[model samples]
Target: MIPQSHPKLHRSEFTLGVLAGGSGIRAGRRDKGLMIAKGRTLLERTLERYGKGFEEVVTCCRDNAWFYSRFSSRVLCDVEPGQGPLQGLSALLAATQTQYLAVIPCDQYSLPLDWFERLSSALSSTVIGVFATDGGTHTPCCVLHRDVHSQVNALLKQGKRSLMALYECEGLAHMAVPGAGMDIDHTDALHGVIRKPPQ
Candidate 1:
């Protein structure tokens, strides 16, 4: 249950964006979102786990837009190709039509079940965004108020493509969740093995 101290945000005000724009050099150039994990595509697992209660779900990808479109309400391509997740994030931010946007990488399948809830609950009128962290910050797994769009655009204009830069610029709060934020960056991770974060 959500604490009463925070404003009760309805799911209708939120849109979920799955980041899938990586070049996938670690996954043999395949679309990481489409890779199989525990008998389901990473994309499928993501939607099944976090798709409920969002106003809509969209995917940002550099390729396979048609395949991603089949699973999401809309599919977006990165605004600048090969620039990395920051470009994809910029596109997602521009495309979001809801008051709030929540993002998760398609390859991170073991995120906390309450991931969205935890992030959303942490958001107040003053707190523009919240992201998950175990020890290191998971910048992509975040919920942002629509008002942050201008900030993101400014960062992009300055060629600040790093997510951590955006995190610090926005003063985003962190929600610590153990055993969360690990992503399948290698081919071996597809076979049900959990990758340990760097110590």
Candidate 2:
């Protein structure tokens, strides 16, 4: 259960969701979210990191329903499995009761807890989404308006998987968060991250 100390924001505002549906091709087919690090599963660590900042928390995954359900009853699956993040986003957009969603991948453990607030403060009527960037490239980490559901669903049906492609098609804005980089896409990468001393 979500702690009572966390403030509840209206669904018309924003909610947090984690995307954990990657194929794990580089991680020897293991579910990255379930990978133990510092004695906690990645999914649990993600929720503990971001859960208090939002009224609700959800996870989007292609499988392991029972595993994710331990953190949130709102666990959802992609509209079509094996497609990519775009498919997972479609399911999240459809399921979200909030006006906006701030997304972070399950593998992104170092994303600051203030992420949603930082991106949200940058929102305006003209912008439908705000993507967090590191250096010059935009990471999958982003915040999106709920109204884009239909457009996202349409693109998923058309077989679009690249997020940068969708961002260009939608004309979304970007926000740079220094030191924010995605590092764990494979087994070696995950090992490199966990073994490193916390700064």
Candidate 3:
């Protein structure tokens, strides 16, 4: 449960953003989110695993908005398709309406149930955002203040599309979340992994 001090953070104030706009060059050019793993699409698994608690969900993808719309509250297509996850992040940030946005990649199927709560708890006057890190930073699995949209746009304008650059610019905080960074980036990884049964 969220601490009482952060009473303003209700489910309505959060929007879950799924980053599904990758070029999938590592996944044999196939849409990684749509790839079937153990009879469910990666997108479905992602939503089921970490999409709880948010009242709204927005998905960013390169194409097939129609299909994504079936599972998302709203679907956004990248303005410049095939760019990268940073472009997807910009699009998601632009479309978010809540005070907080929780982002997770569509291929990240191993996130913890308390992922959003932990990240949200870390946000304060000084920390505008918080990303999960085990040993390495998982930039996508983060919670950001809606105000960070301007910073994201600034990075885009400066031709800096790396998520790390954005995190550094904002001095984002990090929380250790073991297994939160596991993602399926290749066809072989998908076949070797299995989504756990819903709790």
Highest lDDT among the candidates is held by which one? 3
- Give stretches of model 3 more than 4 Å off: 1-5, 191-199
TM-score of 1: 0.89
Which pairs clash in the backbone of model 1? none
Instruction: List TM-scores for all candidates, in order.
Output: 0.89, 0.84, 0.90
Candidate 2: worst 10 consecutive residues by lDDT? 3-12
Per-residue lDDT tens digits of candidate 3, residues 5-74? 5444655688999998888888888888899988989888878777877889999988778989999999
Total backbone collisions for each predicted model: 0, 0, 0
Residue-level error in angstroms, candidate 1, position 44: 0.5
Alpha carbon deviation, residue 156, candidate 2 (Å): 2.0
Give lDDT per model, in order: 0.79, 0.73, 0.80
Model number with the top TM-score: 3
Model 2 Cα lDDT, one tens digit per residue, 1-199: 9543423333236667788888788888878889877788877766666556577677898779888888774898765668887887777777888888878788776666576767666666667788888888667687888877777777877878777767775647788875357646676665544443233
Q: What tens digits encode model 1's per-residue C-alpha lDDT throughout 1-199?
A: 9654767776678999999999899888988988876677888877877677887888999898899999989999876677877787778888899888988888876676777877788898678888788778465888988777887788878988887777787556778865466777788877653332222
Model 1 bad stretches (over 4 Å) = 1-5, 193-199
Model 2: CA > 4 A from native:
1-12, 191-199
Candidate 1 worst ten-residue window by lDDT: 190-199
